[model samples]
Target: MKKMNKAEIQLLHNSIQAEAIEAMQKISEADSVWRCAYEKAPDELPPQEETEKLALLHHDFMTALTLLAVLEKTMPRNSTRESLLILSYEMFKLTCPNTFERFGCEDILKSVATLLDSIPTPEMLTAGSIDKSVHMIAKAAQYLPKIPIVPKEETPTAATVTVAKDKGKEVNINVGLHAAFAPIVPRLTVFDLSVMQAAASIYASGSKTFSTNQLYRVLTGADAHTRITSKATLEAVRKSLDTLQATIITIDAEQQAALGKYRRYDWNETTFKGYLLPMTKIETAYYSGNQLTAKCDCWRIIDTPPLLAYSKTIKQVATIPQKVKRLPRGVSATVNNICIRDTLLYYIQLNRDKGAKLNYSTLFEAAGVDTSDRISRHRMRKAVKALLQHWQEIGFIADQTDVIESSKNDTIYIS
Candidate 1:
């Protein structure tokens, strides 16, 4: 009587299982009533006591199952829940010291039955009643000197789970107790712990054959919104799981090849796509503006010869000869230089708008030089080179592409 022997524990374990199974069946029937009502006249269905009773039944069944699992570890194989009832009754009659010492109960069957009857039926399952029941459970361990041992050391091994390829990757397919009970592992509830044990058994098999969608379905729980909050965290997790970069190698071969051709050059995609192929440089272009300015690298014109010529004409028209003679020598020299540069800039501007390749003759013609002037092509080429070199220094035209080669007769084409 000092301790309930293995036989007595087995009998108690079986009794609890039988009672739990019966309660579960009754709970199922109660659920069916609401389901039928929902299907037939859902709009007219009212909240009722039967529904409440069903909930309580389910709650009690879960509690009983957890206890039975604990007892099973200590009990014999052949003992049934009915046998447990008989044995407890007999033990109580004999005043068994073991039963009283361990459970601190002289009547185990009577105590268990009393506890089961205390469970609230659906009608009586108010918030307060539920709270009371939960409190009773928290204190129930006091009824026994030693709490039932629930195995925590046992874990599912890799061999038990069956993994299969899902989009060419392995996944867990374990169906053991530990895996099943994973949801409740973090809780203080005994039912949760029991589920954890069950899951451990199933988890042994490992991952199963599941596509990305199916895997999501299996792992996703009801409360996803409460778990994932920030966009950054979600994005980071997604990137870690994604196989897109590896897959892209096979999918975008043509793009890769095209990119490889220009990989050595210092051009990015935008330049290649828009202007790389049509890039060019021009050599001998006449400027016909007042100030002889050169165009820069970005295809901008600075000065031309025509403008210079116009300014000179304006000066001659506005100033008298006496006033001009009164001016200093330095001032006159400066005026002359300005006139020349402006004339050259004007001529360049005139040709810039046209598609023609301008040379000295073109400049002379645009400037309206007389036929008797008889300008040599050689002298005109020198003038053009000076203008291009000036522009080159300012980076209007890159020096590397705008070289004035005397060997090519000083004629220029955009490089």
Candidate 2:
């Protein structure tokens, strides 16, 4: 290995630093993204454009770290070695936070410092130099010195649902507005809900049956670039409509539709006026998906199933804005949006107490996923945090609207 004095050491460090100059330039972009998100509201997340930029920032950070993890074997150790190690560790910690936290960083860093000590003058450290620390962090995180979790005393509350120690056990769903429609049908998604909401909007205009075009327009905002539907957006609309029109709500949605079927029949000559209200099943809908004439492709919502079950039409619910239709994919994400929208509407339906904290189970019920048991408590906790962050990003909810997952009560306070 070649030895170096102060001039040689500084020259090498500068050259290496020049190689990763992009990281130096873009590393701090996360702060700007964070500011943009929090500027409007603490819960706000970046809009689509900013979201793309955030991805680019992370990509740059990862790219830089990939290049910097190793020391060229031919270069001898000098005073700058610790600086190199510290730079790599700091960048790894910031860019790979989940990995960092999972590894339990402090112990991992110490172990890394120890390992580097024995390696002698740079025989070329591999990428594993950082990964070695990652491995140590992972082990430290997995089997950390155990600290027993003392259970908090259970407190009596007015929440109507039963409270039992979860014990990491999946129990039958135990919360909802009615036993009939307990869980949201499994296949149903935001696409389905968006279609249903749009159809509900049309109900007032005396449109007994709505065309597919109406749904497409509402869902896609008549693209400023062109009026013709994009293939992807049209396909989404087709699937959503097909999903709703498919004579049977899948068992998953049926549980959610259970709430839909439970609505009492109101026969007012003044309102429904002898119009048949079919109740064999809560959203007993059927329609033609075959491309007939563009004008002829339409749907009859069989019966107005609970379009998210707030005892009001979609128009009556707190509007979440059509912009959210562009929100990224995932069934859970779609459900999260509905749950937040329902929180606003839920209070009105029952005249909920202002101070009462809404429990996680009830949110699951509102999302129509109460009985699905697909989403776990940990994921729900993450969803809550993301939900709040997005709200803060968009200024959708108040700053004071905080969550209470800190206790056994696992609840949300939507002020």
Candidate 3:
């Protein structure tokens, strides 16, 4: 498509702003409709008979927002587009204050303002202007809600559970990659990390794609013994996927190879930054009149050297004794808990046959814990204690009577 000129861009911006204002006005009018239909104010809960109408209105509003976002994508990256985004932000602030806060519009506004400031005037525009324009566009796009259009009367499929045998199954994660980049990028919640691991595992199994339900099952570890049939869990997984998609990770030349080589080696450093799961696509499908199905293509991980290296390391470590390589069953129920397990396993593997007593701080850092925060320090201490207990249980350590010493300086010693 041809890039939009200044005039065309401004016209489009004005059109979208006017449409948004009209929509807000219509929504306000809908409040009166609700009052008449249900004999209740907009702030009050509707009667059962009007609930469907209210739901339909909500769905329509969401669809409108999505369309507005789609429209924003068509415009050229310039002051005009930025102005439209700002106008949209203001409209949301007025019409849907709760939605604005929930979607983090404040941060989006700040980011857009920063990008706009960085852009030079047309007369002073250099080759770098094109790059800055692209950056500004992407930064603005991040704030747009990528919410799937939920169909009414959709029923989710039964969650699928795939349990690998504990004897041979091993999780290989790049301790170095996560330690280096996670603190710098937006910090993923424990559940988000779990979803990422699940996706990684699916990719490692030679599958390029997996469904959101598959992710939820892997995350919940639902089995015959433990059934995790929670709608909330599925919703949480979806939300985490949204957050992961919006998160942008930047890698300079220095950190590129250290983290991993990109699949697209010819990235325009002026415009491009490292994104987790770059080039991957997410598709939502509705099949055979079933619930909306979301799937992620993780082919990008294959090209990522860090992930590949981590997977290779995992396979190699799997050959070691279970006492050293595997965490005890039930220890890794969550992402943070699993981090502790993997950290200890890596530490033990690093010190194998050397009998070196690695420092607690080093292990904690290697485990991907952020030690800069006091709460994180406390968490690390607890993780260390848990690891010690698990080691004793697995006979990796001598016994409960074995004396693991700690110095006054807070360094732990493992004999």
In TM-score terms, which candidate is top? 3
Off by over 4 Å in 3: 1-198, 212-225, 228-275, 278-306, 309-335, 359-383, 391-415
Give per-residue CA lDDT, model 3, range 220-304, as digits (tens). 4333233334666667677666555444333223222223333234323312233344323332322211233322211122123
- Listed in order, each prediction's TM-score against the native is 0.20, 0.32, 0.34
- Model 3: weakest 10-residue lDDT segment is 126-135
Reference-based TM-score, model 3: 0.34
Give the winner by lDDT: 2 or 3: 3
Show where candidate 1 strays beyond 4 Å: 74-415
Candidate models: Cα lDDT each: 0.31, 0.39, 0.41
Q: Sort every candidate by lDDT, greatest first.
A: 3, 2, 1
> TM-score of the candidate numbered 2?
0.32
Per residue, candidate 2 scores C-alpha lDDT tens digits across 92-211 of: 677677756755667446644533342222111100111000001111111111211111222211112221123453222122111122222323453455455555544432333344
Clash pairs, candidate 3, are: none
Candidate 1, 232-291: lDDT as tens digits: 422322332221111100011122223433234332221111110011111222212233
Q: How many backbone clashes does candidate 3 have?
A: 0
Q: For each predicted model, how many residue pairs clash, with residues at least 3 apart or on different chains?
A: 89, 23, 0
